[model samples]
Target: MSRISIIGTGNMARALGSRAVAGGNAVEVIGRDASKAEALARTIGGATAGTIGAAPAGDIVILAVPYAHAVPLVRQFGDALSGKVIVDITNPFNHDLTGLVTPEGGSAAQEIAKSAPAGAHVVKAFNTVFGHVLAACTPEDPRPLDVFIAGDDAGAKAHVSSFVESLTLRPLDVGDLTSARWLEGTSVLLMRAMSGKAVRSSSFSIGLTVRD
Candidate 1:
């Protein structure tokens, strides 16, 4: 169990915060709207809330904000984030979320990594799944959700994998930070598939098989 600071109070943020608390971790929810953050924190239990600028230090920081908001906030956190694991849960989708705002060579996670303090590891994750699914996750299903993770630091990736497992989800190692481009692209495909056009409520699952 690790201390987690979540920067955002939207559905995704609440979902992650609730999960963290349920997993017996100290959780903090930070947002631009202090009242909203406080409300979400209360609902999650065993959590505190505050403005992003005043967020407490934690072992891991989850950037649960939108893609457009991540870069600046990473810069703002600056050296404060050094020596910690950063979980990027944002999708670089625009207003309609039909596509990405980043260029071919750029990704939201990469941008945050570039601006992060030295020693801070940025790992991409939790972008492909919907908030509702995350909120309802249970071991009875025991079926792992495909959660893609990419980071330059192996230790950081491992830490994130443990966190994912704590939530009963699978960690799909997609390679180094550069692979974030494709991971984000995968999210776009997921969105399209889950959309009513093709299949409603369509989602991805991860499985492991052993051949004796």
Candidate 2:
């Protein structure tokens, strides 16, 4: 089991925390609200809670915060994150969260790579799925969920891919860090679809099947 630290206390943070703990990993929920973090930790069983700065150094660190909050938090984590696999799960949505805010030249994940500590291996993942789906979906379902992952570091991407598989999700290798813009942009379309009632079920996943 891997040691995982999630920086956030919102629905996504709690959902991922629960899944990590269920997978028998050491999970920590980090947030500004001590009480909420602690509550989520307790609810997730096997997990712990603490302030973002106090979160234990783990093999994998997931930034589960909003797009606007990601950069500042990453700057604060700074060198402390060196040598760890950092998962960028945030989608760079605008204030209304109805459209993309990241630049077309690059993505939030790419920007994070530029700002992260030199040794930190940044990977973009867990951004396409909704928090409710993450919390309720099961691996045994006929159509397991799929997670898209992208990163410049092959080893780091492999590690996160294994974790996603362990959670019973299909892992789609979408190529290097540059692909993050597409994945983040896809998330915007997903949210819009959800709002339109086009994707009313939490079990619905974005995937493709090929036939020869």
Candidate 3:
């Protein structure tokens, strides 16, 4: 069982923490607010709670905060995150949601990688899935959700893929860290698609199917 530490007390954090618990993995909830973190831990059932900067108990740290806060959060964590796999779930979409807000030629995951400690492995994931859907399994489909992952380190990617599989979710490796740019774009596209009146349901998710 993989130990997981989720940063942020928002919906995404709760979603991931709940899934980790359901998967029988150890979970730790960290947030800026101690009360919220504790409450979320209690809600998730079987998670420890702490504030930001508290040494993470999980080898995999998932950042569920806003894209703008990702960089600074990494900087603050510094070497404390060394040797840990850092999962970047933020979508760097513009406020208007017209497009991604990533710096030219750089995705949010890449930017976070730059600020992360030398030994930290940064992986981009969960940007394409909606949080509401993440909180629970898809209603119409009994299968687990698909989680596309991109990262520079093979070992890191494998670690994340294993964690995803542990939760019964499909982990699709879309190549190295640079592929995160495309993933971010996909997130923007999904956001636009969901915002349109054509799709009224929130239980659906984006996935890949391969026939044998």
Clash count per candidate: 0, 0, 0
Query: Highest lDDT: which candidate?
Result: 3
Candidate 2 Cα errors over 4 Å, as ranges: 95-98, 200-203
Best by TM-score: 3
Q: Encode model 3's per-residue lDDT on 20-51: one tens digit a residue.
A: 89888999999888999999999999899966
Q: Least accurate stretch of 10 residues (summed lDDT) in model 3?
A: 135-144
Give the TM-score comparing model 2 with the true structure, all chains together.
0.93
| Regions more than 4 Å wrong, model 1 | 95-98, 202-212
Q: How much lDDT does each candidate structure score?
A: 0.82, 0.84, 0.89
RMSD of each: 2.2, 1.7, 1.6
The residue pairs found clashing in candidate 1 are none
What is the alpha-carbon lDDT for the whole of candidate 3?
0.89
Error of 2 at 57 (Å): 2.7
Task: Report model 1's TM-score to 2 decimal places.
Answer: 0.90
lDDT ranking, best first:
3, 2, 1
User: Which lDDT tens digits does candidate 2 get at residues 61-94?
Assistant: 9999987888888888888888889999998877
Q: Give the TM-score of candidate 3.
A: 0.96
